[model samples]
Target: MTAPTTPAAEALPHQGPAAGTTPLIIRVHGTPAGQGRVSFFGKGRAVHSNHKKLMPWRAAITDAARRELAYAFPADAARLVDGQPVPILLGAIAAEITVTVPKPKSAPKRLTSWPITRTSHDIDHHARAVLDALTHAQVWKDDAQVVEMTIRKVYPGEGIDALDRPGALIRIWPIPTEAVGR
Candidate 1:
């Protein structure tokens, strides 16, 4: 059987050196539920905040996670006055799946046409809530709305930091609304 072609590889954003480009001190957390801490490399950096970790779900449900991880946090954040450092996220890690990719193989003695698999995509999305949480004090309110906002703002596939397995699939959870009984 034939194979599919990959889209043109996109270059990472070139924002110049981190020296003046507004770097954030991001901390990460992985526990009963993955948690993240954002702070500067140094300077006793920290913010008193709490963000939730989403559960891995099915395809349809993935949408809400994107919205929440990408949009909600930014929306819920407190308004920043000025000069206060904006948060910069590294990424999150939680549950994961592994996808293997094919590669040419080379042996210590010789090379062979036989196909060998190399590299794997570490599945992740729930971790995004942390990245999405970073923003000016005012912007990230620590709420689902902020996550939703972030999802809407970032281009698809780009919102989740580069941490998922290459062939990893994603799951989305639906946004909860009021019950019909009221």
Candidate 2:
């Protein structure tokens, strides 16, 4: 019997980026019960007085994210840059933030999920809270380094086993150095 012949290499489509070229990425899993902090204003228009309580919340979440990153990249986290600890993630970055809230019990019995959150917290507000925390945690050199961002907020839908839980999932990756057009 004749041996089977392989198809020409050119016949196959390029499925993805070349191996070894994938951008460095990190994922920070969040608590199911955490709520994004809200910005508020205090009497006399003092920013510090208005944000005193919120600062602690931001710090706690930032610490959590920092710990996760360090756990995954101890060596990188320990590295020094210009005599200071290096921000493991650097360069232009892209971030995707997905916030999950528990399904609203007040909805009609037949409605398992709402199309969107109608609460006082806007999607941008949630994103800002996280981004600010990330900046504080030094996930990157600065929040300004994030050139692209996508944020979404939704309540648990049907078949989502973790409906009782709520949290945010953050995905961050460095944009290719050459792609920055700097």
Clash pairs for candidate 2:
32-166
Which tens-of-lDDT digit does each residue in 1-182 have in candidate 2? Answer: 97665555323433322346443333333432223443456664434322644466467558777787788778887787787767867766777666665556675657555435445255776677678888877777788887778767656544332233455666777766544333
Predicted structure 2: clash tally? 1
Q: Write candidate 1's Cα lDDT for 1-182 as tens digits.
A: 85654333232222212233332222122221222344454678654223332222222133333344445445423323475533322222112222112222342223322212222111223334333322222223333332221212111123233222212222222222211111
Tell me the spans in candidate 2 whose CA falls farther than 4 Å from its real position.
1-57, 80-84, 108-112, 115-120, 157-164, 178-182
Question: After superposing candidate 1, which stretches have Cα over 4 Å from the reference?
Answer: 1-12, 15-19, 30-124, 135-182
C-alpha lDDT of all candidate models, in order: 0.27, 0.59
**Residue 16, candidate 1: C-alpha displacement in angstroms:** 6.1
Error of 2 at 167 (Å): 1.2
